[model samples]
Target: MRKIIWLASYPKSGNTWMRVLLTNYLRNSATPVDINKLEGGPIASARLWFDEWVGVEAAELDDNVIERLRPGVYRCMAGETHDTLYMKVHDAWGRTDRGEALFPADVTAGVVYIVRNPLDMAMSCAHHWGVDIDTAAESMCDPTFATSRSLGGLSDQLRQSMLSWSGHVQSWLDESGLPVHVVRYEDLLAAPAATFGGVVRFCGLPFDAARVGKAVAFSDFSELQRQEREKGFRERSLRAPGSFFRRGQAGAWREELPPELVNRLIAAHGEMMKRFGYTTHQGGNDNVD
Candidate 1:
């Protein structure tokens, strides 16, 4: 059986964009693949998959119980799939309360970890989560940060522990035993051909320069925004104020984020930011300096 490859990233970090590109490239159809119909594979935290595999309603179980069952769920999913499955994940690479890895290592083949500047991420995340930028930034630093944690009603997806922006990135980069291909969102924007080509290579797919170019063009930001405008994107959160594909530009935080809020994010995620070449306005030095 082909192993499962993870399309892992923090929320609002270009995971969908990568999915779009891959779908276009793989399909190689005469027309651009429908934004809604793209076969981007299953999300790691879908409650339906968990319920189906575990033979119990995930909504009835406590979060800890669900967390403990996650590795088995993934193993079963991987075991059933005949082809390489590219599953999208937002959960940090960490262990459950019982010391079990959230994502089972034996089932994983590799990972394509997408990373974006937290400054831009803050603005997008705020829009996505229906919160202010300050609130979004604070949540990115909160160690216990998670999505779908509400007990009031069942969510479509399972609980995803983000464990802070810095923590999330470090968790995946540091602990995922499988081979990892890191893709910076900025690089993908700046050099689509080279950057995405590298991703294709990392995935062990046959290289075709022309196909890569077409995929890049097919998944253009404007096209995605246009599709969202015309047909409406299902991935868009109901809480989002505007289109899900709003302002798909790098470094948008410069204008969207205030100086103080920017400083706060820089202070919280300084070392990681510096490592990823995101410099603060305060003379390219972290607050820790």
Candidate 2:
């Protein structure tokens, strides 16, 4: 069986940019993969297809029954796709109780985990949803946040999904035997060719400099934001464009983030944030450039 490559991430953590990069790269190549509609819902489309069956006609069942149905469903779903299936999954690594069984057991590959600085991620999330920065920050820290799987219902679910990009990214880093390429969003934004060239190599596809250029051209935040502003792409489900693409640069958070709050976030996740070369202190935001 050909490998299934899952581009996994916490929401608003640069998954869309990764998809754009991959889709752009594959479109100009002979890669056999379907650019299917990425489904979003209460239970992620991946979780629904891989773990449970839900449709217009829904059936409630016990966990054991859901477990029993997964393999057959996965086999059917995988068989429907062509050679290699590149699916985008937003669920965190620890969200599902089914362990590795939540995905196709025969998955030949793991994922390309895309990470962003939490500070930047918070700002991005705020702008995307038109929420206040503190609301966005709270969403990251609040376990009760329903949308993110990393959020705990009442307590911490793995980590607070809204504020837990470090934990989310680290989970993939710790997984062994899986080819995990950690790509930073800021790096991609800074230099598309080198960053996306790495992704192209990881996907085992022939790299074309032109394709990288095309990806960069399309992935540009300004262009995307303009398109969204003019065409109302944000309202469309299949291609919902928004301020999510706002400020793809690394340290825009410094200018946008209040000093006290920045210190708080730094204190909360400073150690792991430093791991990705982000600064929690008040200084020049030229960490990645």
Candidate 3:
């Protein structure tokens, strides 16, 4: 069977950036595929590789029936052939139904889970969704927050979205026997060559140091932001242009978030937040002096 490599993460946690990197690195992948229009593209497309709820929806006709048909959906997403398929997924496995996690017959060879700071994720999401920081903080722990890719709006959407983040991260982390390689978004940003090298090696693909370097250099926040603004690729989002890459550096929340809100996120997901190496209180510098 051909191998399937899924780039998985919580929403707003840099899955697209990883996709950009993988699309550039993978031998078979050329041109970054638009996630929204993936179904009928050159790459046999499906959202099975995405987050839990999304996989459920993609697998079933009705969103409410996601859990029932999730396994079938993942199988379909993998399609008939097993040629190496590099896919991007935002939903976390631990957060999704167990049936959903059982997809990709070879777990060890197929998963790349990226973890980012919840605080920064919250900030990025708020900017992307046009909401306040507090709402974004709460959404991190709620399973219902509608990511850019999620369909249908429910009454408890906010709560669901928030809970999903924790569930998703924990899901991938809990899988001990699988071939899951956890990548920290912070490390990827700080050291693209080394971090992405791990991804290249994991996929059994040849690592072109120069090309990988070229891709990383080209995929920087400024360049991506420029592309989004002038190229109109990301203009459709509710967020302002350039906001897509707002503060790509970690801990921006420390500088941008209000003191009270920072404390709130810390209290909410503080322990989980530290798993990614994010300090809750910004090293005792609470005052915005």
Best by lDDT: 1
lDDT value, candidate 3, whole model = 0.58
Q: What are the Cα lDDT values of the candidates? A: 0.86, 0.58, 0.58
**Model 1 CA deviation exceeding 4 Å by range:** 280-289
Candidates ranked by TM-score, best first? 1, 3, 2
Across 61-135, the per-residue lDDT of candidate 3 in tens digits comes to: 444344344445455545654566665555444323444443445422567788887766777877776777777
Clashes (candidate 3)? 24
Task: Quote the lDDT for 19 in model 3.
Answer: 71
Give the poorly placed runs of model 3, Cα more than 4 Å off. Answer: 27-61, 94-108, 143-164, 175-177, 234-236, 239-242, 280-289
Candidate 3, residue 249: the lDDT equals 80
lDDT at 203, model 2: 80
Error of 2 at 109 (Å): 1.8
What C-alpha lDDT, on a 0 to 100 scale, does residue 176 get in candidate 1? 66
lDDT of 1 by residue, 3-119 (tens): 778999999999999989888888888878888876646889887778889998887888998899999988887878887788889999989999998988898888999999888
TM-score of each: 0.95, 0.73, 0.74
Model 1 — which ten-residue stretch has the worst lDDT?
280-289
Per-residue lDDT value at 246 in model 2: 56
Q: Candidates 2 and 3: which is better by TM-score?
A: 3
lDDT of 2 by residue, 30-140 (tens): 432222322211222334354233341113443444444544554565666666666665544532344544445465365777877777677766766567888777666
